[model samples]
Target: MSVVTNDEVRRELVEFLDQRQPDVVREWSLLRTFAEQRTVDAVGGCTELLNSLRRAARDGQEQNPAAAGFDDVRPMLRASAGGGASRRLDLLSLKEPLLRLWWEHRAGTPAVTDGALALSSAVDALRMVQLEEELTAGTETISMQRQQLTELSTPVIKLWDGVLAVPLIGTLDSTRSQSATESLLEQVVVQQAKVAILDITGVPTVDTMVAQHLLKTTMAARLMGVECVLSGIRPQIAQTMVQLGIDLGDLVTKASLADALSYALQKTGLAVVSADQG
Candidate 1:
């Protein structure tokens, strides 16, 4: 039989914990190191843990890993913030004091050993639930951070009146390319700018695939009534574009962002002449 499968063991363990609930919470709360005391929600979390154990001890839904009381742990874990290996060890550490008390209460008896085993299983179950929830929270946090990073990397700048620019600065993979395009188009529609600039000065290489991404973004902007300017084409990149026979087909290209900005200013019926010019 499984450790938690014994009815008599569960009954005895629950009763012992109920009578000495305060003691268990008090001792477990004391085991915290100074850092843990500050990092974790100490006394309250310990009380919640003890209560969860007692509930799990009698909970018929305990057969499933998703026990009713385990859900209570999620809030505590969220407040803990750094719920990594140390937290897990601390959870297991709780079992020791409770077991010691049980041993002292009924030393050298078969019932003592049995009840100890049951309590250990219940605590371990609670710990596993906490660990699982921590992992889930961690994954969600990472995904959100990644998305924020992507948005940061692909920013749409309102460079001039009726002109917006996207200075892509890394490998233009399909995902990033799509993100860049979406951001640029949204700004174009929002600002209703006349010219959209896709500057590739920081892009390391220009290949057929890269060219395709540029063309798709350009065409997308054009469909929205915005003329797209492809800038940052060095001599080497121009040569590569030619050798690869990647026809831009009347796509306006510029040698630098300065030139692109000048062209955009002109196309929008604007100018950047000398300050002294009449």
Candidate 2:
């Protein structure tokens, strides 16, 4: 039910930091080393944070000094999160030294309660900012990983001249299907491929949706003047396709990639024959 003036809190905080400078430096040095080992960049490390704290305390009369402190370390926090460091551990390492210094220095002061309360608010603000940064960083990381996975899942390899192959593995979700279609289409243009092979041997199952995705991809390749061949038709998938009434309607399907490749080579006016056969 009591109010603490910014000026009063700032004075107390400055004194606290100044008095415990030695301890602060020593603790901060250890934290800096830890951050460097983890991040290799000291831009938003302990030293920068200490500078921010000092600036925030000096600018106590500002609207939100704690927020100012958080801004300084925001970039560092994001880097830590992006690097997949333990957020809780990083926070503990950063906050413990400052909190210990405050606790030791705030004892027996005239406005001890008010100073403690103000410091607590500042600490809480920093924690909240850290959480937000971590969340943003985590979301960005997940998005990047998802894109990498998509690329991995739908790998379009240049099997031979004028021929490209996309080996699809796993369940064909809408997103993955879209990605595959785009990647194959792009490769068709880039490679000037006359033939594109879609091998789904690693695919676990094929439903109507999977069938539609294949149709769409082949259609796209056709528009680009490239013949798309669907390979890796196991018995179970063929049966499912028939039962689901998924009409692949004259889009060339092959039993295996080797067979498809052979067909493609033949179309390109090439042939593979054994020396003994010759």
lDDT of 2 by residue, 180-240 (tens): 9999988888899999999999999999889988899999889999998999999999998
Model 2 error, position 144 (Å): 2.3
* Candidate number with greatest lDDT: 1
Give the alpha carbon lDDT tens digit for every residue of 14-118 in model 1: 778888888887788788532466425567778788888888877633334478867777677655545555654357788789988888876865577767767
Instruction: Please give the clash total of every predicted structure, in order.
Output: 0, 0
For all candidates in order, the CA lDDT equals 0.81, 0.77
User: Of the candidates shown, which would achieve the greatest TM-score relative to the real structure?
Assistant: 1
Runs in model 2 deviating more than 4 A are 1-7, 11-23, 30-44, 54-68, 82-90, 93-109
In order of appearance, the predictions have TM-scores of 0.86, 0.78
